[model samples]
Target: MTDARRASGKNHYLWGDHCDGWRLIDGPDLSLREERIPPGCAETPHVHHVARQIFYVLAGELTIQLPGRTVVAAAGEAVEIAPGQPHLVRNVGNQDLRLLLVSSPDTAGDRHAAEPPGLP
Candidate 1:
């Protein structure tokens, strides 16, 4: 049986600087989550060894810093990150940034912190 899940009523966790995340689906092969990032907050740069991820923005703006460029996704937009890609997520807007993070093959135990590209 499948049940409805909402961030407000799901398993919530905090990350980064005052960020919030709720796991909507946590299966062994796939993971889905709703994440909220306060303004001016950013997650540490990291890479997934095998899992590919997609960030779909639900509200505000999402800025993803990649190796040589930065991608910005506003409401109704999404960014796709390939496996082994080192990227950093940031909330550069004034309001709260809300997005759905989807990972295939799951990311648990596969994340490795990495230095942002272009940094000496």
Candidate 2:
């Protein structure tokens, strides 16, 4: 994850809003993606082929909506998603939502993400 205090460093993407830090922790076991999503921004709906995902809310609350149910996860809470399950996330707060998302099956890079119908 990019240091919040790092003033003169480059970040992951061009939101100018959310700060992100990504690293390959294990050689072939898992990966970590740290993100800070500004209010009103949301991640597109996607799926994994052979891996499971765990989303942990570090600071702010996040609204996670799967195909069947929608749940609000507060800070220090976590949610697990099994393989082939389609899911998506949204930041429904006024503050930046800091989150840690981990994915498995990193060795084979078996990821299958699809954009939602309304999204480009």
Local lDDT at 106 for model 2: 63
> What TM-score against the true fold does each predicted structure earn?
0.90, 0.75
Whole-structure CA lDDT of model 1: 0.90
Q: Write down the lDDT that model 2 would get.
A: 0.70
- For model 1, residues 1-120, the per-residue Cα lDDT tens digits are 122344346488878898988888999899999898999999999999899999999999999999988899999998999999999999989999999999998898999999985522
The residue-by-residue lDDT of candidate 2 on 1-120, one tens digit each, is 235453234434333335454442544678676667778878767777788878899988888777757878989999988887777778889888888878785614565576552421
Model 1 regions lying over 4 Å from their true place: 1-10
| Residue range with the least summed lDDT across 10 consecutive positions in model 2 | 6-15
Candidate 1, poorest ten consecutive residues by summed lDDT: 1-10
Error of 2 at 37 (Å): 0.9
Cα lDDT for residue 114, candidate 2: 66
Backbone collisions counted per model: 0, 0
lDDT of each: 0.90, 0.70
